[model samples]
Target chain A: MDITNLESMPGKKIVKHLGLVQGSSVRAKHAGRDLLSSIKNLFGGELTSYTELLQESREEAMDRMLQQAKSVEANAILNVRFSTSSITQGAAEIYVYGTAVQLEATE
Target chain B: MSGGSFQLIYVIGLLIVAYLIGSYREKRHYQSIIKREHALNSLPAVNLKTAPKGHFQHELVMGNVTISVDYFKRFLALLHAFFGGPITSYETLLDRSRREALLRMKEMAKEKHAALVLNVKYETVSIFKGSGKSIGSVEVLAYGTALIPSSQAVASNVATTTQ
Candidate 1:
């Protein structure tokens, strides 16, 4: 599919305006690493545990975004973005969004 | 020991514990900031080249990246405290999410064979907020045309390199 035909391709498909598709998920943990983080902070070093946590959360968000795109029958997505917020001291939300487009040939 | 002296000793012990915990928290927060900055710096620089008119190009795929909010909240809380207010956790969460989204968008550009991503945008919403607690999240979107130089352009580059 040519990039130009990504929009306005023939066939009475349910064309979504602005292709504003979104996906989100919430996660919570029992503050397991807070004490460890405190200790690491005092000693002056990297907190490897938190590094892993961020990575996992980001992946979950992306997966959700992709799933949303698939449901809409979009062959390609453009202008994808992400966001996060705290639900509580120990919980957080990750969200992903993008324009879902169906491609078509220009000829 | 006298009663007054006993009370003094108890207070001193409590202060010592508070000092230890406070110092530890401070140290951990700084360490995380340094790590995140390092990660951001390590990313490769991207360059874009325009494609020729009327020529279709192959699809490109970019790399992937992940980020967490728990780690990010610590940094936000510290920043919020600096401004003389109760530590706010939502700031950190939103910041981390935005960074992760941008990284992922960049990865997609690289994979899609695009030289650059442009016209990026961001949006956020509040999911939960209450007494002594508030939570919200943000989304960032990046979009751009993926392109490669025409055959003629490629040939010229090859000739220049060989010469």
Candidate 2:
């Protein structure tokens, strides 16, 4: 399925508005990575492990969102947005939402 | 009394070292960020949801950065919390991470030969949330759709023909 954060596909026409679809995933940091991150904090720099962990979580959320779009028979998803919130000290939830729609070729 | 003095000295030593290293590292990062931003000035990323009128291909592009708060800044933040003032120490951290994320996104667009990026948005997350004891870090993610103008293809064609 085609996915974009824009309101509408640039070259395509939206034929059907399928409403809002969302996906979310929550993940907790591993103890080992936390230890490493603390050490990295002392010097100050990018937290590679946390970056990777969050990236993975985001991908999973996107995947679930795409699945929802597919189930609804939508050809594209638009106006996509992502939000992150910490549910607890170590766990974070990544939520992605977008409007699912069917698009017709304008060309 | 001597043991208490020893603890105080140790804390002071850590603060001094953290301050020196953190400032040096932040300076270097800002230098690199400014240089790369100058280099990538040609590509403009905007918040417009619709692309400019053109026959172009679109692709999703994103860049994310996670930066950890150094001990020195965290200490400053603790003081700021106590005094209830604007925590200026963390401002640079957020600014650097946001710029870095946007630059990375633009770099990806440049790779795709996209003339413009649209509907750019940012999401910031405090990955390790809660209190001061935890090592705090912020993650910034910048995302947009890249529009590769069809004119570039014709331009490339003309170049090949001229050769």
Candidate 3:
């Protein structure tokens, strides 16, 4: 499926609007990883483990969003957006939302 | 040595060490960011929702980074919070993270040989909230649609419309 953050896909027309499809994931690192991160925080630098964790969470959320689009018979998702919120002390929630639409080639 | 004196000395030592190392690393990161930004200046990323008229292949590209604040900055931030003034220390942290994320996204665009990226967007999240001793960290994500010029142009007979 074609996906873009733009409102409409270029060179294509939105044949049908499938409404909104959304997905979210809440994730947290293990205690050991959290401890390591705090130590790294002492010196200030990039947290590779946290980065990977959030990246994976985003992908998972996007996958679920795509599944919803697929279920609606939409060929593409448009105007996509992402948001992150701290749910608890250590957990983060990644939310992705987009408009599902059927696209037809103008050619 | 008395327990109180030893504890004070240790705290002071930790702050000094943290300040030295943190500033050094931050400087290095800024240097790298500037160098990469200069190198990637050719590839433009814009927030325009509509793609310019053309025959191109569009794909989604994204980059993300998570940066933790050092002990020194965290302490300064706390002071700033109490004093009600700008916390300059954390400013550089966020700036570096945002720039790094955008650079990484542009690098991805370069790898795909895309002419440019459109509809660029950013998401910033302050995670690992300051609780139970650990300080907070920020995560920045940059994403956009890469328009790669197609090698074989589609038939010109097709009517192209943008809405």
* Candidate 2: segments with Cα more than 4 A from true spot: B133-135, B150-163
Q: What is the C-alpha RMSD of each candidate to the true structure, in Å?
A: 9.7, 4.2, 5.2
Q: How much does candidate 2 score in TM-score?
A: 0.89
Candidates sorted on TM-score, descending = 3, 2, 1
lDDT of each: 0.47, 0.86, 0.87
Q: Chain B TM-score for each model? A: 0.38, 0.87, 0.88
Task: Return the top candidate by TM-score.
Answer: 3
What ranges in model 1 sit over 4 Å off? A1-18, A41-46, A105-107, B1-163
Summarize candidate 2's per-residue lDDT along B1-163 as a digit string, tens digits. 9999999999888888888988998999999999999999999999987678768877788888988777878888888888897899889999999999999999988877889999899999787643555437788999999887777746654776999
Candidate 2: tens digits of C-alpha lDDT, residues A1-107:
77888888766899999999999999878898888887888767788887787888989999999999999999899888999887776678999999999999988
Report how far off residue A26 is in candidate 3 (Å): 1.3
The residue-by-residue lDDT of candidate 1 on B25-127, one tens digit each, is 5456546655654655533323333333444343332222222233234444556756877664544444554555455545554444454333344444432
Per-residue alpha-carbon lDDT of model 3 for B16-106, expressed as tens digits? 9999999999989989999999999999999887788777878788999999888878888888878887889888888999999999999
- Strongest candidate by lDDT: 3
Error of 2 at B86 (Å): 2.7
* Residue B85, model 1: Cα distance from true site in angstroms: 13
- Over 4 Å off, model 3: B131-135, B152-163
Better of 1 and 3 by lDDT: 3
CAPRI verdict (incorrect, acceptable, medium, high) for model 2: medium
- How do the predictions measure up, each by TM-score? 0.44, 0.89, 0.92
